[model samples]
Structures are given as C-alpha cells and as structure tokens.
Target: MKLLLLLLAPAIMFASERTVTMKVSGNCGSCKKRIVKAAEAVDGVKDAAWDKKTKVFTAVFDDGKTDSASIAAAIVKVGHDVEASKAPDAAYTKLPDCCQYRDRTHD
Candidate 1:
C-alpha cells in the first residue's frame, strides 16, 4: 500500500497542473480581456493571460478536468482566433473595430 501510494503521488500531481501557450490573434487591451476571460470561463482553467504585442495566450488548467483544446474553443467562442481554432465569421465580425486583429488595414 505504501509503495502504491508513493507511485501514484507523482501522477496525481502531474494531472493537476497543465500549462499551454499558443498564438491568439488580438490587437488591443479589450481583445486581451476577452481572450483571458474566455479561457478562464472554461472548467478547470486556473488562470489565463494574453499579451497583445506577442499575440500569445497562456493558460494554466487542470488536466484532469479540461485540456488545451477546450480552452481554445472557449476563446474562439469569444471571437479570438487561437492557433488551432478560428472564431466564426459572424463572431469575428461582431468585434469592435479596434479589436479586429485580422484586418490588415488597421495594422
């Protein structure tokens, strides 16, 4: 029993923490707010941060309850484009002019 408990401890700890960083298209502070809020809304997501200049979003979540894909989907739902997922056209169009990262004219 002692050996079993010790062997499972590491696995349990590993399953509790997961961090992922991926590209998220966003141009300004409002975009950053939406992206981070979307990620944090997902179950098991402990924290999320997005950098406008780098277009990178980092998320920390519990592997046992959620994965990177779920977090990405949540962000997409909020009209941000993640590396593996893109927001729907309708959703993207609803973003404010300043938050339209896909529009090169604004850049």
Candidate 2:
C-alpha cells in the first residue's frame, strides 16, 4: 500500500495538467503540421494534434506552466487562426497556397 501510494501521489499532484481543444482554421496536411508545431512550441505544452477535417486543435500542457490563451497566441504567431485569436496579416499571407484558409472560410 505504501508503494502504491507513492506512485499515485505524483499522478495526483500533476492532475492539473490538462488537454484543451478548440477550433483552428486550416485546410490540409501542411496545416496540421503547422498547427501542431505552433501549439507545441509554447512552453509547457506536452503534446499537440490538429484535425484537418474538423479544423480543431487539441493540446496538452501543464496548467501550472501555461494556459490556453498563451497556447492560442503561439499558434496565431505561426500563421494559424485559433477561435479566439487571429493570425497576423503578414504571417497569414506568407503561408503556402494550400495553407491559405481565410478565403475558404469566407466561402
């Protein structure tokens, strides 16, 4: 029981780590790679995944070290649009043709 308690203690203490999923506009495999890379670039982000069809990005991070807003900002910085944040015009314009998502959203 003592050994089990020791193992469980770490899990309990780190329970604040969480995963958040939100809409992120994108169109293809390249978008997925870019989105995930942007998300994981944020400090404390443990993992990130983006779904092209759903236009959703999911990220796991230690809440003690980072928050959803910070992660979203990182994605925006890399030219991806998150639900609450928009990528910069210059960065968005620099994306490859297949990665351009603004026109598709308008359509």
Candidate 3:
C-alpha cells in the first residue's frame, strides 16, 4: 500500500486543475457560444465561459492533459482570436456577419 501510494503521488501531483483567463475577440451570442465550445472541447478542460461584453474567456482544465496554448488553439480553430493564438484568415472569414469583431473597434 505504501508503494502504491508513492507511485500514485507523482501522477496526482501532475494532474493539477488550473484556471486561465484571457482576452478573446467576439461580438454576440453566437460568438460567445463558439468561444466557450471551442475552449471546453480541449482534452482535460472541465468547463469554459466567455463574456462578450468584456471579451474575456475563462477556462478550467487539468494542466497534466492540456495548457493555455492548446485551449487558445482550439478557440482559434473555431474562428475566434485569443491572446495566445489568432484565428486564421480562412477561419475568421467564415464567421457570421454579426460575429465579425475584427472589422470593428474592439479589444
């Protein structure tokens, strides 16, 4: 039992839950949905939320399985721009008219 506990200690220590917040570009309800969905889709992400008014996105995830970079990449892939990653032109262009935040003045 002592050996088992010792062996599992490292794994338990490595699997820490972390919360990260960053600015993301978005405009409306659809944008919020896309942002949250993209962030939450990453492996190890427990949950995610976005506030359109503030353009801030927050995510809770296991550091052992994922990191902020991966979460940002997921959001970028789905047509949103996060502090660590930018959505590709193709992805950005695919956004709906109401969700196109880049053309306007925003954070």
Most lDDT-accurate candidate: 3
Q: Please provide, for model 2 over 12-55, each residue's C-alpha lDDT reduced to its tens digit, 9 standing for 90 to 100.
A: 78768899999999888888888888888888899999988788
Q: Write the per-residue lDDT of candidate 3 for residues 44-103, one digit (tens) a residue.
A: 999999988888899999999999999999999989888877899999999988888888
Task: Report lDDT (CA) for all predictions.
Answer: 0.88, 0.88, 0.90
Q: Which has the greatest TM-score?
A: 3
Give RMSD to native, each candidate: 3.6, 4.7, 2.6
Please give the lDDT score for candidate 1: 0.88
Query: In terms of TM-score, which candidate is stronger, 1 or 3?
Result: 3
Q: Arrange candidates by TM-score, descending.
A: 3, 1, 2
Q: Whole-model lDDT for model 2 versus the true structure?
A: 0.88
Residue ranges of candidate 2 with Cα displaced over 4 Å: 1-15, 105-107
lDDT minimum window of 10 residues, candidate 3: 98-107
- Give the Cα error of residue 30 in candidate 3, in Å: 0.3
